[model samples]
Target: MRRRFWLLLPLLSLAGALQAQAPLDLPQQAASAQPAEAADYQVLDFDWQDKSRQREVPVRLYWPAQAASAAVPLVVFSHGLGGSRQGYSYLGRYWASQGYASLHVQHVGSDRRIWTGNVFSLIGRLQDAAKESEALDRVRDMRFALDRLLAAEQGAHIDRQRIVAAGHSYGATTSLLLAGARPPDAPAGLQDERIRAAIIISAPPFYGQGAPEPILAPVRVPTLHVTATEDVINVPGYHSEAGDRLSVFEATGGQRKRLAVFTGGSHSIFTDRAGTGGVTLNPQVKAATRELTLAFLSSVFEGREEGLQSWHQRWKPLLARWQ
Candidate 1:
């Protein structure tokens, strides 16, 4: 009973972290209508294997319905811990509508099974050294997925130069690895040169080892960091404060780095179907994130800075803290 009580307490804190939409006294300007809606998009599901890693990664691909003038840009998504490729459909769907391919890849180890075994199992694995090495494994999954996708028949429709790595939470860490964020413990040659840019959603600070700045020094690619002021992920043995996300944004050395810190959102906002409550569902937060991320990708993927400029001009007021 005590153990269960301790576990549920964090979940309650997480629930309580979500605040109601702004009150009448605290008025907020709505964001510019980000082209969040994708045009028509097609979804395909497949299980791909990496013989070197001896793992089969489940992937859900979302691409523009109509053929493009040239190959469409692709963003490979890695979901948060215990989350499947299907987790953040909002990002996948929105990007696809805008004529980009969004591929969500699932890492088998340290995945959904961790949460399903018991309510507390997921939290337990966070500090489990045996399970700690899985982050590197997840990085391998991203590289292998890219190798296979760019070689498949469908590869003909993807713009090889515009591939971006994106993820939230632990998945965000995986994307960072691909973008050149190296943990001292991770093996050499894990970073991929093909990932031209990256979107890091709720990336945690490199805790206890050293300063997050030096740890993230290797990630010099164009990057975007997305998180909420109240964003906190409380696992059993670890502490994830909003500062964790902020540290990554502040420390990154990317020449074109951007941070979108929204007001009153929680860790759950990154997922499509899951909402912690009112704050995660706030229209202002949602609109700004969707539009800002789209604009960032637009700038990096299409080699056009217009969308990003429009974002700065129109959505600046809604963003609580940004650079």
Candidate 2:
């Protein structure tokens, strides 16, 4: 069992490198909607040290320049494997502009540093990043970052009850673990009760694990799953179909869950990369994704489903499924 798990690590860690080979035939829009500019929010960088684990957790916090009278909502984001704190600036800026604090946590062990060094050793690095130890450390990085954030001066402005966990690909797996996923032989105390909702983008399955239902049944938080029909992960010996995302959504235990499947896009389209998916559709999907996240947040925090309905109406043409 351990050997089989080791063999699947490459497929798990390299999920962000999904190739977008699907042909996009959607009607062209006159112009893609742009996210708010960086000037709208205040960006703060932090390099925190976890003395116990001897790990470095780097993070970027995007706070709204225009403060609200009451505490503001917060979204803690985890990036995909091989991504960094700066990878998803679009979502951070947008969320901050709309009165929510966005905290992006970077896990060093599985981050972009693995892409450096000898090209011949790339596979080895990916395997190491996907090891169970590093995966657990990613979760610890998030929890530790949250603790540090809440203790900081700006933490006073954050609305603790409105906190959400979000991520893409491998990071999505992290989000699920925080949302209460229980893999076999995993340790206890993985879930953080502070996360009221979650936004999972292009989530990969728990490889070498038996059935997804048992593994994902503990994720009871309100979840919004975002994926595309072409979000396929193709490694040398393993392949993860876009349908896996749907299966996860189905198995995830939540009565208030929602899913939005774009017609055609690569898994990497959600990242900062603008060209992995169709150039015309990439920005469109990103814009829609950010807006969808905000709508999901509104529904979770403010109990407002109107924004979600409105978003569905506006972006229906780009969607293969929404529910």
Candidate 3:
């Protein structure tokens, strides 16, 4: 039980924190404005089976409706704990409209299913999802998805050189692993060399891990860290402050890394859900996040810092720190 307690602490804390937020009325929003925006891009759903592990990896791809003359860059996204592929459509749609293919991978073990069933069993489910096995499986899911996607017909339209790994919360930790973060207990060769950069948003510390520096020191790829001054996770006996995101940024091993800290927003604001932060500030932060990600991608891939600079200047009022 003690071993299980340690393993479950981080994810359980995250689950509890997110549960504290009001549920998003996504169904109503989907019926109203989501379809209008859907016209700008094509959303493709796939249920991929990794035969080796017998796990189902569900993904939603937001592809540009009008194909670009040149191969488009790809962003493979992983969702946070209790989130599905459908959770971050805003970012996917925005990226797709801008000529980037965003592939959102849903890790079954840690998905929304955990929120179902008897309330008494919730803790057990959370524990299962937080296990190291599930964490490693999330990484393999991304790797396998990439292999399959690159071999598919759409692969010809993707720019292999500009592939990026991105995620929020628990998913951000997964992105870090792909970007070369090596937790003390993590096995070797988890890094995916194909991912040239990473976008880590609201990433929590690897709880129970001694320190982030050694774990993140191996991450050599360019990275963009996004968080809010109020991006904190609170649950019984566990508390992760917004500064944890900065510690991660500081420890990450890359000269090209950038950090963006919004003035005020909750950790869940980055998800598709709305109203958990501030009614007005929620949308503003989302828009800024979308723009910041695009700017970061441009800086890393096109060698253009102008977009980053412009974004910083434009969103300066809402930002607590931009570095």
TM-score of each: 0.85, 0.92, 0.90
Q: Which clashing pairs does model 3 show?
A: none
Clashing pairs in 1: 38-97, 39-97
lDDT tens digits, residue span 230-265, model 3: 888776566777888899899999889999998777
Q: Global CA lDDT of candidate 1, please? A: 0.71
Query: Regarding lDDT, does 1 or 3 come out ahead?
Result: 3
TM-score comparison, 2 vs 3, better candidate: 2
**Model 2: per-residue lDDT, tens digit, 1-323?**
45332223432434444344443443344135357465768899999999999999999999998644669888999998888999788899889989899999999998989889999999888788877888888899999999999999888888889889999888888999999998876789999999999999988877778888998999999999999998888877668889988998999997899999988878788888866667777778888899899999889888999999998888887899999
Runs in model 3 lying further than 4 Å from the true structure: 1-38
User: Whole-model Cα lDDT per candidate?
Assistant: 0.71, 0.84, 0.82
Q: Model 3 Cα displacement at 62 (Å)?
A: 0.3
The Cα error of candidate 1 at residue 42, in Å, is 0.7
Candidate 1 local lDDT, 1-323, one digit each (tens):
21121111121123224567643222244322233454588888989998877888889998788635568888999887667877777677778887789999998875566556666654565333124456667888888888888887678889888889998877777788899876665568877998889999877666544677776888988999998877877654545678778888888877889888876677766665333535324555555666678888777766778887877667665456877
Predicted structure with the largest lDDT when compared to the true one? 2
Model 2 has an lDDT value of 0.84
- For candidate 3, what is the total of clashing residue pairs? 0
Candidate number with the higher TM-score (1 or 3) = 3
